[model samples]
Structures are given as C-alpha cells and as structure tokens.
Target: MREETFKKRKPKIVVIGGGTGLPVILKSLKEKDADITAIVTVADDGGSSGVLRRSFNAVPPGDLRNVLTALSEIPELQREIFQYRFKSDDRNLDGHTIGNLIISAMTDMHGNIYEAIQLLTKLMRVRGHVFPAAEEPLNLHAQYVDGSTQTGESKIPKKGKKIDKVSVTCVEKERPVKASRKVISAIMNADLVVLGPGSLFTSILPNIMIPDIGDALIETEAKVVYISNIMTQLGETEELNDADHVRVLHKHVGGKFVDIALTNIGIVPEDYIEQEINEEYLLQVEHDFKGLKAEVPMVISDDFLLLTEKSVYHNGEKVAEEIFKTAFNSQRKIKKYL
Candidate 1:
C-alpha cells in the first residue's frame, strides 16, 4: 500500500541535458521527491573524459558521474570523496577524477553503459534514474555556416563559426548504439519535460538529435519547457536572446514543440559579470518577452539568478520551484480531461 501510494504521488520529471548545469537542477529535483530521470549526453570529448574515452575506448563518464553525485542519497563527505581527483606525482593517476575511473571500470565490468549506470545507481543510492544519451561514446558532428564540418563536442564551440545544426554519430558503428529505450519511455511518461540550463548545442541538442529520441519528443503529450541559459555562451549562442534560443530549438526539431520557455529577469551585477567573462567566458543572457511570447505558448520570466563571489548562475531552488508549480498545474489540467 505504501509503495502504491508513493508511486501515485511522485511527479514524473525527465531532464535531458549534460554538463555542469544538469547536476545543479537535478540536486533540487531530488529534494522535491520527483520521480527523476536524467538523460545525460555521451558526446563529451574533453579533458579527462576525452582522455579516458580515447585510451580505454569507453563512453565519456564525466557528465554521468556528476549527475550520480547530485542524486545520490548519501552523506556529503562520501559524495565529495567519490568526486575527488588525484593530485599526485603518479602519471597514471594524476588529472583523473575518482568518479570517472569508477564509472569507466564499471562500464567495462557490465560490458555496456546502461547496465553500468544501473549497477552504480544501486551502490551509490541514487534517488533517481541516470541514463547516457547513447550507449557508446558519441561523436558530435556540427556543420558551420562557413560550410565546414566539425566533429567533437569540445571542438564545436572553439571553431568560432556559426553552427548550422548539430547531429550525433556513434563511435562504435558496429555496436548498434542509440539512445536507450528506457530514456524514450521516461519521456513518454513524464508530466513535465525540462530541456536545459546548459549549453544549447552540445549539451541539450545532442540528445534531441538522435532520430529515435527526436521522434518520441514530437509525439509525447508532456509539456516541453526550456530553461533559458542564464548567460549567452560566447561562441555557441552569442547575441541570442531568450526567444531566439527557443526558435533555434524549434528549428532543429522541425516543429513548434516547446510549450513553455523559462527565463531570468534579474539583472546580474556588472562586477560579477566581468569575472564571468574572464573565468567562465559567458555573458549575461538578454531576453525579448515579445519574441518569446509570440513563439512559445507560455513564457515565464523570474529571478532565477544566483549571484556568487566566483561566478553567476541559476538558483536551482528557484528554478525547481517554478518547475513544480508547472507540474501541479499540468496534472490538474490532465485530470479535467479524464
């Protein structure tokens, strides 16, 4: 009876994206007791993740590792211990985070990434599901407006050329890699689908570009909400306002699919803004409510900014609060039809 009651109440929320921003949102969602499923990108090819993928022929584990930490129902110290990276003289161990190594080792043990994450999810006591967008290390293929094709998630932004569109190609072609059916099912069942607070092209679109995933997204009954990035990514989304971001997403998906677009209206301090450019290479994202309202059905602008001494970013709790409000309203509307 308790199990049935718990299942009936939990809001099914599926978040699709990768990178550092994903974990921030997941941390808050776990606290909400939502039935969370994080569909992470497998197109990472930078730093330790890239090195491991190249060396061991394993799927990049960095994004998945971070998401696991966010959802883990364990002591804070234990989570920090898992995230620890070696800072020693040993050439083999140095520069590699422990969590990345653990994931890579498990991927080898289970002979696949999906099974590996499931096993690690149990051991880590993760409060939700985390699935890689692809079972294999994915190659991000982007064609720039200059008529050039760039391959690799890290390389895409570095080119400094306008991206025409992006697509994913699996590294192990013979292995028959694709976004897991489990991920597809989660999207189908979700009450609220959150797209991002992450990189638009590299993090969010890679998952959507997968043909099977794209089809499911178009067919799903869920209200797709895009969390506009708090800042404009210099190379990827320079000069784009909130509405422009939404349109780009619709353009790629080939339909007006996003039902709502969430944006930040709070001003980022110029003092903090300069540091963001120097340290993180991001500029404050501007919004055009007129454009957003015309394109998306609903546009909610709120104070989602979290200002810090080091960087400027989205306040996860504030964003999650907005998400839950939408979720509840969606549930009510669905019941009216039934």
Candidate 2:
C-alpha cells in the first residue's frame, strides 16, 4: 500500500540553470507529470537579451522565455509565435525575439519579474513554475586562471582563457544577487534537484552561486542530480571530463551536494560536427569514470546522446526517465524509513 501510494504521488522536481538544454529536460519531465519548477539564470547580458536589458532595465528574459515555452501547454502555433525572432533590415527590432519583448513588457506592467513570470506562465498554461535566479538582471563576472577578469556572459567565452571562478552581481548596484523566497523554497522542498546539461560556467553556475540558492542546495534534503553535458564547450569547459564538471560545481556550492551524476557514455561520430557550423562543441567530453565516482556518491552512465540536424543534445526522454527513476527509488527509500 505504501509503495502504491508513493507511486501515485507526483515527485516535486526542481531543475536549475539556463540555456537550450534546460528546456529539453523540462519538456520531458512535463511529459512524465512531475511537479516541476525551473530556477533559471538571469545573468545573461548577450545579444537580444542584452539589448532589452539595457533598454528596458529588466531581467534578461531570454532564458526565462525558453523555459516558459518548454513547459507550456499552449498550442504549437502560439508557442512558435512566442519564440519567433524578427530578421528585418530595420536595425531596431531586427534581432529581437517576440518572447523577450513580451516578457520585458510584462515585467514593466507588474513592476517585478517574479510576478510577471507568474502571470505569463498562467497565460501560457505552463505546466510548472519558472523563477529567475534574481528579480533583477545579474551581471556575470569571471576570474580566469591567468588572473584576468571579464564581465558579461557573451564576452566571457570570447577571451579564450580558462575560467577559475564565476560570480553574479546585480546590474544596477554593487550588491549581492538574491533568489526570491519562492525559488529558495522550491529547492528546500523538492524531491530531487537536477542541474545542467547546460553551460557549466555561464548558465548553470550563475544560478548556483546565488547565496540563498546555493545554501538551499547544500541544506536541502532532496537528492541532487547533475546531467553532464555531452560535448565540451570551447572556452568554458574545454577538455573537461565529467568529474571536472562535478568538482567545479562543488567548488562553487561549497559542498558535495551532487549525489548522483548522469554522464553520457555514447560516442559522437567523428567528423560528425562541422567545425564552422557548430563552433560551440569543441570536442566530445572524454569520460573519466574513476574521477567521476570520486566526486559523487553514485554515477549513472548511459547512451544519453541525441544526434539530429548536425547538432548534439541530451536525449531528453532517456534523461528524464533516469531522473524519475532515481527520484522514485530515492523517495521509496525515504518512505520505507518512515
């Protein structure tokens, strides 16, 4: 009876980070009917999001927009329209995306981003919650191994230097970036907290470095799982193995919070990625299973790669299955103890 009851209850899963990968896992989790909350990074100061952040003095809506669309139950056409980007000859709105503009407008109307996201999520019929790591736009600062420093997410990778550490600050003032009460609560109360298949430095760490969120991650009773990226990124995670990723995360969070790591053991076909076309993927991430086992309590290795259209991605369905399986077994153990 207890086993049956546990199975009936939806697992409260909180996924942290930003970038394209976050959404892929999110959409899959939604399909599984997990109670989801996405804590996204707002430290982006790049391209259309950067322009809007400067113009409107709003939270960078790019990451939040993608998360919203991913968990939304709205019609496919409306979702497309929400994600549509303008490519007009006109300079003003040429590179602007419709979703970014809408989110910015909504932020203005509500006078706060948290409320704006709540309202927007309701309208989109989002399956779960989407909260920005901070209410305001955050500026990402990186200290490279060579003692060099850089600000701004887009420009950080351009330096071509090894990043030793990264931190976030509010754009308007020299103050600590804060995650809202709800964001912290989500982490504290979650059944499982999943990190990345996204950019290690820019996307995932930005959210983790926020004091309250980082602390909650460390203090939370939930099992934390990290889905390691399939390919190595040029500047951020160049030549980094799966364990190196976990070490960076632990170094930032100040604790060995990641209980399990989901690593991709599948191989990408050689000459599969066009260098010019897919500049982001520098090389396939070499697996160091021993090093990975040292970082986390348990390592889950699988063929978690999805290759399509000359791009490499996590096979979201398979990853989500592993996530729920982990969460379910973890929950069942807790229930047994009770």
User: Would you estimate the TM-scores of all the predictions?
Assistant: 0.93, 0.96
Writing each residue's lDDT as its tens digit, candidate 2 over 95-120 gives 99999999999999989889999999
Q: What range of 10 consecutive residues in model 2 has the weakest lDDT sum?
A: 329-338
lDDT of each: 0.86, 0.89
TM match of model 2 to true structure: 0.96
Which regions in candidate 2 have their CA more than 4 angstroms from the true location?
1-4, 274-276, 332-338
Highest-lDDT candidate? 2
Residue-level error in angstroms, candidate 1, position 268: 0.7
Clash totals for all candidate models:
0, 0
The candidate scoring highest on TM-score is 2
